[model samples]
Target: MSKSAVPVNLTDRLSQFSELWSQKKVAVLNDYEVKLAKLKGEFVWHTHEDTDELFLVISGRLTIQLRDADVVLEPGELFVVPRGVEHCPVAHEETAILLFEPEGTLNTGDAGGPMTKVAETLR
Candidate 1:
């Protein structure tokens, strides 16, 4: 198989795979997959059993709702949801993001909604 590009145009990279929840392979490292995700609305409130996930906002805005607070993220800012914390992510408008997580992370760790990506596939 060929390698995906490392330096990518965020807009174009995300356009290549226009699917919610499913992560497209932009580039890969031994422990992480560089992903571009376009999201809107809300996601299920979930938690990872033992792995933390990092969410980087490349465009637009995102809100991470935890038990006690909501953390807002804007372009160029990133947020990390520690393992075992039940949280839900919401986007009021169209959002583009880059996420870094361990190789096998259930996108919706707990209360997964309709857009949850159950299986990890490198597209």
Candidate 2:
């Protein structure tokens, strides 16, 4: 057993931040990072050419709009956007989500802008 093996309480971690669209790193697995974010409004259309992105809705609703269609997710639902697929996430109200992606994966992906942010580790 190790300190890292301690169970993480997602709700407690989520309460530590309030910035919309900003991701907070909660844990890590292999070369991946498990992140949490509070989202609202529309996000920039982007693509992660190297790896897929996973989004799990913890609360409220989220819509992942792809070039061909829109994938809507509600609480307890998850969606994966494959690599190289351009997508935008929109949430009509405040939505809490869990994201699993490779370490160093940028939030904005290829559409870097002011909205882009480095996922900060939660303390």
Candidate 3:
């Protein structure tokens, strides 16, 4: 297929990675990157001080737990977590999500730990 005509399938891209909480870049648009993450259990309570994070559920259910409330998301639903707002993501089962954020935004945010990853594209 022509490089520009190639299709990026969420289900297909999701099959490339199994590690929870780690993200794989699927596309780039100007200064932003499109990422896919497989989430299970609870993620670190973190805040992206420099950029807002957009989370779009592709399959299964996802809950964004904030200090004030929990935002529940299902397939095709999206929520944007504003910059610097501390939050955590929890998935009781394997959940797939699409994220849109500025390039270089770390997966672990300011709560960096072993989960911090050097961002790279998967396809």
Candidate with top TM-score is 2
- Candidate 1 minimal-lDDT segment of 10 residues: 1-10
lDDT of 2 by residue, 13-121 (tens): 9999999999999999999999999999999999999999999999999999999999999999999999999999999999999999999999999999999999999
| Worst-scoring 10-residue span by lDDT in model 2 | 1-10
Runs with alpha carbons beyond 4 Å of true place in candidate 2: none
- Model 2 TM-score, all chains together: 0.97
Query: How much is the lDDT of residue 110 in candidate 1?
Result: 63
lDDT of model 1 at position 64 = 94
Model 1 TM-score, 2 decimals: 0.83
**Which has the better TM-score: candidate 2, or candidate 3?**
2
Better of 1 and 3 by TM-score: 3
Q: Which lDDT tens digits does candidate 1 get at residues 1-123?
A: 334444556677676766665666565678777777878888888899888888999888999999999999999999999989989889998888888877766687766666666434444
Ranking by lDDT: 2, 3, 1
lDDT of candidate model 1 versus the reference = 0.78
